[model samples]
Target: MEEIALHILDLVQNCVEAGASEVSIAITECRRDNLLTVKISDNGRGMDQATLAAVTDPFFTTRSTRKVGLGIPLLKAAAEQCNGSFTIESSEGKGTQVVASFALDHIDRAPLGSMADTLAAVFAVHHVDVHYRHEVDGKVFMLDSKEIRQLCGDELMHPRVIVWLRAYIEEHEKQVGGEQ
Candidate 1:
């Protein structure tokens, strides 16, 4: 993916496909450390050691719809190309967590594109609850879909609510210096 947000979208979709009811995405940009880290955790049907071991292989996938899986492998390569690292932890029935870090100032580091749109798109369609947090330096912006659902009640999927969500996410992204 050309943008880190696209990578995030892909990973989150994977979590949804795995039957996740909740997902948490955290992005931390530490200029002092020259690091941009993304961590995604999902309460989904996770993998066993054997599956987890093969997740990084571009040719391996749990899906029958496609012959190859490139999401995880591509993300790993993106991080490594920027002189950073990627790691995943999972258990058969528990959940999964994926972490990818990139050197913030690396020449090859991808931009974080259209995050507000990404969040809005995911939130609008998926039934899963999501908690998104973005931290730049020490400032943080957080958005929790659970809270929104509670506030909106049965109107959670109303058109106005979706618009509100997009606007809210955009404001937060701007506050955290992640506006695209």
Candidate 2:
């Protein structure tokens, strides 16, 4: 993926497929620390120890469709290439968490990309509850799909509403992250 947000979308989609009802995503950009971290946690049917161990292998996947699963491996490579780290943990009956960090100013670190579009795409399809938080330095912007469902009566799939949500998220992202 050319963008971190796309990677995020792929990871979260996997969680959704795994029967997640709630997902939490956090992005922390700390320029002072020269780090960019992305964490995603989902309340879903997590992997067994055996599966977890093989998760980073491109040849292993829970899906029956294709032979390869590249999301996790790609993210791992992306992080390591940027002089950072990647970690994933899961419990069979509990959930899963994946965290990838990148050197904030690394020459090869991918752009964060349009979180607005990424999130809007999620809401457009799945009804999963999503809590997303983005922080740059000390500034923060958050979006809760459940809260929006409550306030807007679950019209997030509406075309007009999706447009509004994307624009809203983009504006907040620019404000909190200081112009992308």
Candidate 3:
């Protein structure tokens, strides 16, 4: 993926396919440390040791649709290209967590693109709840689908609600780092 947001979307889809009911995405951009870190956790049926080991292999996949599974491998390569690291931990019947970090100022590091719209789209189309926390420098902006659902009731997917969500995310992004 060209953008970090696209990688996030792909990872979240993996979580949903794993039968996750809840997922948490945390992004930390620390300019002082020159690092951009993304961590995604899901309460889903995780992989066993063999599956976990093979997840980073492009030719290994549980899905029968194709012979290649490039999501994790591509993310790992992206991080590595930016002089960063990628790691994943999972246990059968427990959960899964994926962490990818990149050099903040690296030329190869991808930009975070349209995260708010990504979140809104996932929430509108999927039956899962997500907690998105973004931290840049010391500022933080959080969006919890559960909270939004509670506030908006059954109209969580309404057009006005999506508009409000996008606006809210934009405002928060500006407050953190100005136009993410």
Candidate 4:
């Protein structure tokens, strides 16, 4: 994947495949600490110890459609290239959490990309529920699809909702980044 957004998409796909009804994605960028951290958690059918152990192997994948599974491996590599760390934890019938950290200023650290759009895209496309919280420094912006669905009825996917989300995220990003 050329961007971290793609990696996030891949990981979310995995969560869906695991039968997750809800997923949570959190991103933290701390310039003072010189770190960018991405964490994804899903209430899905998580892997056992054996599968977890091999998830980082490029040669291992549960999908029969492809011989190489590089989602986890690639994310790990991206973090490592930036002098950071990647960790995956899961349990059968429970859930999984993938946390990756990268050096904030590393030339190799992929751009954060339009994370607000990424979250909105996922929510708009998937019927599954999700709770997304994005925090930069001490400020926080949260989106809960289920809540939106309750308030908007069938209009959760309405164009206005998407537009609102996109704009809300953009505004929050600006607030956190300070008009950079």
TM-scores, in order shown? Answer: 0.95, 0.97, 0.95, 0.90
Question: How well does candidate 3 score on lDDT at residue 60?
Answer: 86
- RMSD per candidate (Å) reads 1.3, 1.0, 1.3, 2.0
The residue-by-residue lDDT of candidate 2 on 97-157, one tens digit each, is 9999999889998999999999999988887989999999899999999889988886778
Q: On a 0 to 100 scale, what is the lDDT of residue 43 in model 4?
A: 88
C-alpha RMSD of candidate 3: 1.3
Question: Residues 3-121, candidate 4, lDDT per residue (tens digit)?
Answer: 78778877888898899998998878776898888899998999999999999999999889989998899999999999999999998898999999988889987887776777777
Candidate 4 Cα misplacement greater than 4 A, ranges: 158-160, 178-180
> Per-residue error at 129 for model 2, in Å?
0.6
The lDDT per prediction is 0.90, 0.92, 0.89, 0.83
Error of 1 at 22 (Å): 0.8
Best by lDDT: 2
Tens digit of lDDT per residue, candidate 1, span 1-180?
889999999999999999999999999999889999999999999999999999999999988999899999999999999999999999877899999999998999889887887887787788889999999999999989899888887677777788888898888788889425
Q: Order candidates by TM-score, high to low.
A: 2, 1, 3, 4
Task: Supply candidate 1's per-residue lDDT for 5.
Answer: 94
lDDT of 4 at 88: 98
Runs of candidate 1 exceeding 4 Å displacement: none
lDDT of 4: 0.83
Worst 10 residues of 1 by lDDT: 171-180
